[model samples]
Target chain A: MATLEIHDLHVSVEAENGPREILKGVDLTVKQGETHAIMGPNGSGKSTLAYSLAGHPKYTITGGTVTLDGEDVLAMSVDERARAGVFLAMQYPVEVPGVSVSNFLRTSATAIRGEAPKLRTWVKEVKGAMERLNMDPAFAERNVNEGFSGGEKKRHEILQLELLKPKIAILDETDSGLDVDALRQVSEGVNRVRETGEVGTLLITHYTRILRYIKPDFVHVFSGGRIVESGGAELADKLESEGYEAYQTKGGVTA
Target chain B: MADNTPAGSTTDGAIQVGGPQQPIDARVSAPASYDVADFPVPHGREEEWRFTPLERLRGLHDGTAVANGGGVKVEVSAPAGVTVETVGRDDARLGRSGKPVDRVAAQAYTSFEKASVVSIPKDAVLTEPVTISVHGEGGVAFGHQVIEVGAFAEAVVVLDHTGDTTLAANVEFLVGDGAKLTVVSVQDWDATAVHAAQHTALIGRDASFKSVIVTFGGDLVRLHPRVVYGAPGGEAELYGLYFTDKGQHQEHRLFVDHDTPHCRSNVAYKGALQGKDAHAVWIGDVLIRAEAEGTDTYELNRNLVLTDGARVDSVPNLEIETGEIVGAGHASATGRFDDEQLFYLMARGIPADEARRLVVRGFFAELVQQIGIPELEERLIAKIEAELEASVA
Candidate 1:
């Protein structure tokens, strides 16, 4: 089983005034098959933590120790982190004009799996995964994420999450632009990967609507730069009705 | 290149092959000649010569460069029912498609010892492509080529250039009535080689002409492709792809003259520049005269600057003298790598360099596929990959 530990993480972004700290002394730990939901209002350093963990060049880690099964995660390159079983489903999927979805998925699979998958079986696997996500088969030939709708882009992200099958899959705001049906389909795709029980999931969102479908074992209420509250699944239901007004102040409350 | 069949029959907003023939009312009787003195020398200040580096011409423009060099070795492979011949300048078929419109072209016309003419007979269909390999044997050389497709014939002609030399030449295409032709001209010269050529074509009544120019190597290369309609219902498509490396300058100037009624033309050119001092230039010009009613045309040019110190100047101009045209438009774009695209690919586990390569390949994929020649397409893709590999090594 994989274990990801982020201890006292401090991250900053280049702002007009200079390096502005976004995540200050935030800590979280997720084990194999664990579903951790990070919920907060806008500008609460939620996405910053996600991007920083993915090693985005825009987000600088001022002080942090991120490890996966005792292996240094912060020291890895973005692609290296992915090869080391870390998957990031970005909030906004990028459009690659000429690279077809099939090619991109194959390349990514090759990179992560350390070898090119057999062509016939890989094609079938892709067809199966796409069918599970309700994606059109024609999408395999179209350029990656180009001209896709908001819901389509989110579904594509989940498509990658299923195809790559990383140890820790981070879905940042995956439900933002999704409709009720699309959200259900995407959550179903994620749960299929979760059923393998070999993957840990970090679900970052602003609403508890998605929780009704993919239940999170742990709920962390993020505020300012760190988590202001931590609890079990019941905490999500509590925040669902109570809102984050109480946690907006400072110093989290334990469950 | 999956479907290498010609594209004119299927394109929308583009003229279809074969229709009723009509008179050419906007034709200009150009002073066709092999005399360099008939054309005035360019001072690099003229509109056509502005972007060209004068000194880089190696005396080809000023009547100083002699054709007494080792010259180029030309080889031709023609299918059955085709003919290839070397004729003197006085051959009746010579200069029928077009004449030298500029000083450099006139100079080339006057300098070449003989011209190679490849002709496809009427109603002939070549199952295999006609290949012509032109390798520079060193020094300054001037040459000319004429590819004539007969009525109701179909053919593909490939002009392959390689080796080193300072060369200038003129090429002409004569598309007969109801004929279809696709010509691919590849300029793969040495790093020190300088090559310039002007390609002219005359589309016949209900005929289709497609030109694909691929330029990859050369210290300095300038090519001008011009097309004019011989009668109504003619069609023309011009496609070009180039890669400019460090200290290299590649320029493509195109002029499509809609001189007849119901004629159509489409132009698309894409280029990539890498390394310090690398430069690329694309000038697309389309003119529809007053008498050319029902004229349809569109042009597009796009460039990718792969590194710092690289520059691209893309200019697309369309002039319409009549309001009776079906369509007229042009576009130009030049940009570097899309960071978000790179990030997306890398986030999926592909290495940074691999992602960059994939992006570049995608940028040119559409145009390359339109070439419709499988072997040539594969070679061009591999060449592009080799170029990217060199940047890191």
Candidate 2:
């Protein structure tokens, strides 16, 4: 079982003018087998929280304490955090030319598992995971994210999420460009991992559509770079109908 | 010396050497000749020698380096039906494909004592590749080699160069009508070696020619590979990969002349440079003449700069005299490592050095696959890994 605690997290990014704070003293905690959906409008600093937790150099953690199972996650490097079982399924997966999908997956598995996976079983495992996502077997040989459609890229991210089996998985806008069918397929993948009961998922999105498939244990209304309200699944239904306009008007948040 | 104009002369009054004064061809200014005097010594200002370090050539340009008998040892092994012979310079089959176009090549032609010739008989399809190993012992040496495939014959040849020496050589490939030939030339010389070589191939009617040039070693290595078609329907594919390390200079200049109608050609070269003073140069030139209608050609060059102080110069030139050609295109790009790419790989738990290795290896994987030899391909990949290890350590 793993636990992620983010207390008073303050993140800033360098803009043309100067350093601008994005995450303003946010607090959140996620335990293994728990699903947390961070609902927000545009520029609500939802993705900023995702990348900052992943240790992106662009986001500076001005003041925060992020710990994973009592380890200083904020002090660890991006790769070290990954090896420690923190996975981020990026919104726009980068295109790595000439690197095949099979090689990338195997290398990642080796890094996390501390040894290369058994070749025979690993091949079957990859083939099975890819088939579960309805991905073509030929996709394994193609370069990562190179020439892949938007839906295909999302499915690839979910495929990694299923295979890496990280303790804490952050899905950043995984449902942004996905269609209805792709959304259902991707959500099914997340739900399969959720059923494992050994992973904590932090699904960040602007729409409540994904929450319909993967029910969140808690829904947090993010506004002005911080979560202003927290409630049960009923809160999501409320926001879906009432929309984020109430929070923006109450917090005087622009966009 | 006064009568001979400098090779770099661009003045209107500068006279052409060893030939009657006439309008210079825009494509190639210098005329081809077997005589060393016909080509003047390059003074670093000439277009061809601008990117080269002439002082490191060890006298290959000025004709002062005498042939040291044991400088290089040549060994050739062919299958039973193939003919391999060491013939004198006066052999009638010598210089049949193309003449020396530069001073070093002309000097090599005038200086070499014995030439090695490998011939594949008509209608013969080789099951095994013919291997030629040139081991540089020491001192200065010049060499000439010819590989000819008979009509309808298909053969693959491997030319391997190793050891240390100051050497200039010329290689020719004569692909007969309807023949298919694949050549792999590897320059894995010692660190102190200096090498300059010209590789020319003349493709016959309806023939196919493919060449893979892999350069990794030597202090200063300049290779000029040229292709010319003898008849229409001939096809040529040239692929090259080079890894330049600290204080090394590697240059590859290619020319594909589509003088015949309905011919096709494609050239692709990729290189990686690391450490201080590591330099790489790629010049690709494709010329489609007026009579060569329906000609299809494309050339591409890409370079990966691994570290600071490494330099890459990539120039692609395509000249078409007639619009009746099928297509003509060229592309060149030199770039440092992409940060997002590194981040993407590292975000998956790969270390920084290992991620760099993966990206660089991926960059060259396409060209390395063109070698078509499993053992050689594996060895090249190993060499690339070793090169990466040096920097990572």
Candidate 3:
């Protein structure tokens, strides 16, 4: 059974000319433990999909049903959807100064788990997770995503995922603005998620850099408000060379 | 040494030595004149006290009919998630010694409007410091403040006295047991205000009290801070900072009483007086009771007169009734800002305003950082910037 199912999802924003459609009926799905990568051009409504799924107040969902493990996901609150195992690693992580990263992650973990744990055990668990992700343990005590480099923000998101252990994680262009070393660290963190049994992922990116480490089981192409084509890993290669022109053609695969 | 002799005393003429060279003039015992009835203030009956112009004291007291009104009333122009409320349900006697604050004297100002208050629930661990502004922009602004730090509770309270223009204000604080409270009060008024405020605290056992007061404005401002340690195992820290420019007069008076055993008290007040005839004073007194065995007491007052015409007078007083106390000491000095700290921040490419802000933040950071509330701390940083602009902008 599919872990996540997106059916005819449409989104728009209230702009000067009225509802300017951003996502024009995109549909896709992923089964349990499978990783799917969505490759798109700029302004292709890629980040919109991530925001709409996370229930950010900015993105308006004009139509669609988003289900996670057969549960209706779109009807939940932002934090509720978060608690329901839908995680979005934001491309531009907000700088929440004064709120320490450790404090934020711990609170998030507690909120997700629905109970409080011992401080000693919580610290140990956090230490172990940071070690697995190669993050400085002191970063946890620093303010949340505040004063962090681009790479550090990405790593901090991964740390949260590790600590919270969400069922399905969405990486919104996490590959952007990363150096080779930072990219490797991030890919390793994602790979750890995949190895932890039954964890589903949706990697949204403009570049295929991260795909080199965490191979996607399926690849979907998004353009002009819809999914133009879907296939195996070769689809990524074909688009890489031909540059999405073939997918724009009228005869392109419409599903 | 002769230097340790009592002020205005003749050591050789004493009929009998009470203890040592220090005069034991029974007639000149420590003055307990701060009681509600006899305390000397501008409320009534005096001429040297005629300095309080009615225009300045306009709304300082309730008319002949009503009891004293207490509560720091503030109607915020912004609808943020903060509200000002009274300290408790008892409406009449909100820390006035039941004397309606009007008859108690020493008030150059009182609230014309009804009093306002804020309450943090019992055992409520409010991580953020609750900032209360006794904002008096134009008219005479007189208000009261009552704070209750519940049992086993911990909180940080920030009171900022400021105005769009010149103004005056009064505030009071009451704290409860096994509870910890830290208050940071910054006064940034227009150059014309004559600000006079008083703070009284009654602390219980196992509780900690901390206060940082920074005074930056007022033509003539006086602060009287009194604290009474009502039980054992209590700790109190008092700190003050004042920067005066151009004919500003700021004074701070402290009275810390260690009435029981195993108590600790410390006081530090520093200031910089600049411009022609600018003046500042630090008057502090710590009292150790007969039963205050194993008590530790310390006091320090330092001042810097920046310009040749500016002046500062600091006085630290300590009276020990028991020899069994572990420590009792006092220090006072009046002097300019640290040129080194300013140069360091400037060399780091920080602009003058930002550098000034950093210096100011660091100067107060010892207490500001101790505030555990993330959101409140952020707001405090912003408030500090706003005050700096008002003063220097």
Candidate 4:
């Protein structure tokens, strides 16, 4: 089992004016087999937390302590963090030209597993996972996200999440741009991995529609670059009814 | 500066006498000739020689270098029903496709003792490719080769160059009416070698010609591949891939002359440069004459700069004399590695080195696929991987 701990995380980005802090002393903890939904409005620093933990290089960690099973996650490189079982499903997955989906997946699997997967079984494993997401078998031969549609890109991300089976998976806006059907399919994929009981999922989103499918063990209201309230699933229902206006009026800066 | 001095006394006199005296067509100013004296000795000032380093030619441009016999061994292997012969320069079929437009090519034309001619009979389809291997033996050499495909014949030919030598040669392709020909010319020379060659193809009525030029070696290599249509309804496709390493100069200049109506042509060349002082030059010129109506042509050049101090000069020139063409367009781009692409691959647990390799390989994958030969494609991919291994180390 794996556990991730983020304490007093402070992140900043270089804007045109100067250095501007985004994540202001945020704290969170996620253990294996636990699902945590970080709910927030626009510009609430939710995605900043995802990219910072994944070592995006664009985000500067001014002050923070991130540890994965007592190992210093903040000190690791982007790829090193990935090899250490930290996966980030980006909101807008980059388009890598000329690299086929199959090759990318196999290369990633090799790096994570420390050896090449058995060819016969690996092919079947990929085919099975892709089928679960209703992906076409021919999609394996296409370039990774080169010309895929929005829904297709989301499904591809979930496909990787299912196959890689990282210890901690951060899904950033996976529900954005996805239709109702795609949302249900992608959520089903997350739930399937959740049932494995060996992975911790940090699903960051602005809507509570996804929480209806994948129930979160805890709901955290993110405002002003920090979590101002934490509660059970009932809190999500309350936010869905009352909206984030109350928090914004209660001294929570817009960004 | 004495006006009474003899006209041919100074070194610049030769350039003045051989160069175009008056303003001529910008597309092709120098007239094609068979004699070396008709063309000027390039002093790196002419438009064609601006990007080339004349000092590295090893006397190929001027008349100083003599042919050291046996410098290069030419071997030809062909399937049944095909004829391969080493005929003298007087062979009536030689130089029928195009004339020598440069001094080095003209010198090669006049100096080569023997010319290899490969002929395919009419309507004969070749199952196996005709392979011509030119192995350099470390000297100055000149060569000429002719590949003639008869009417309605279909054939594929592979011209492979290797080893070390300062070589200049001319290769001609004659496609008969309704014939289909594909040529794969590879320049995989030694690191210290110098090479200059001109490849010309004359497409016949309703015929098709495809050329894949792959260059990966040689200290200084320059290739000029030109295409001309013999009659209407001809089609030509030119695809090239080159890898320029440290201190290497690889240049590819292409010209497609659409002199006949209803002719179509497409050109695409991609290159990757690595290490310091690595230089790559690509010049694509397409010309559609006044009488050539309904002409369609497009040219594209893309270069991936892999490291610092590497340089790429890509120029695409299109001159259309007729307004009744279907379409004409060109594009050229030279860029370093895409950071977001690298980040995407690395974010999936791939190390930096492997990610770099993937991007470079992906950049050239399109042109490599145009080879249409599985074994050759695999070999080229392996060669690219080996090139990456060096820089990574």
**Per-residue C-alpha lDDT of model 1 across residues A169-242, encoded as one tens digit per residue:** 99999999888999999999889999999899999999999999999999999988898889999999998999
Which lDDT tens digits does candidate 1 get at residues B274-360? 778887888887878778999999999877766667767776766677788899888776656555667788888999999878777
> How far off is residue B205 in model 1, in Å?
2.6
lDDT of 2 by residue, A1-255 (tens): 699999999999999999999999899999999999999999999999999998888999999799999999999988999999999999999887667899899998999889999999999999999999999999999988989999999999999999999999999999998899999999999999999999999999999999989999989999989999999889999999999989997755754
* C-alpha TM-scores of all predictions: 0.86, 0.83, 0.49, 0.80
lDDT of 4 by residue, B15-85 (tens): 11122333223534367888888887878878788888989889999888789996799999999999999
CAPRI classification of candidate 1:
medium
* lDDT by residue (tens digit), candidate 2, B1-393: 221112221111121223222322333436889999988888887777888898898889987788989779999999989999999989999998898888899999999999999999999999999999999998889999999999999999999999998889999999999999999999999989999999999999999999999899999999999999999999999999999989999999998988899999999999887778888888887777778999999888887766667777777767777788888888876666666777888889988788888778888988888767787789888988877786643
Scanning candidate 4 chain B in windows of ten residues, the lowest lDDT window is B8-17
> Sorted on TM-score, highest at the top, how do the candidates line up?
1, 2, 4, 3
Per-residue lDDT, model 1, residue B393, is 28
| lDDT for each residue of candidate 3 in A1-255, tens digit (9 for 90 to 100) | 448899999998888988888888888887668899998877778898987887766679899888988899888766667777778888877643234566556556665777765799998988888888788877876755557999998998887777777778889999999999999999999888888766789999998778898899999998877887788888888877778666556423334
* Ranking of predictions according to DockQ: 1, 2, 4, 3
TM-score of model number 3: 0.49
Off by over 4 Å in 1: A15-18, A237-255, B1-46, B59-68, B77-83, B88-92, B294-296, B322-335
Local accuracy of candidate 4 as per-residue lDDT tens digits, A1-255: 699999999999999999999999999999999989999888989999999999988899999799999999999988999999999999999877667899899999999888999999999999999999999999998988978999999999999999889999999989999899999999999999999999999999999999989999999989888988999899999999999988876636753
Give the 10-residue window scoring lowest on summed lDDT in candidate 2 chain A: A246-255
**Candidate 1 — which pairs collide?**
A228-A252
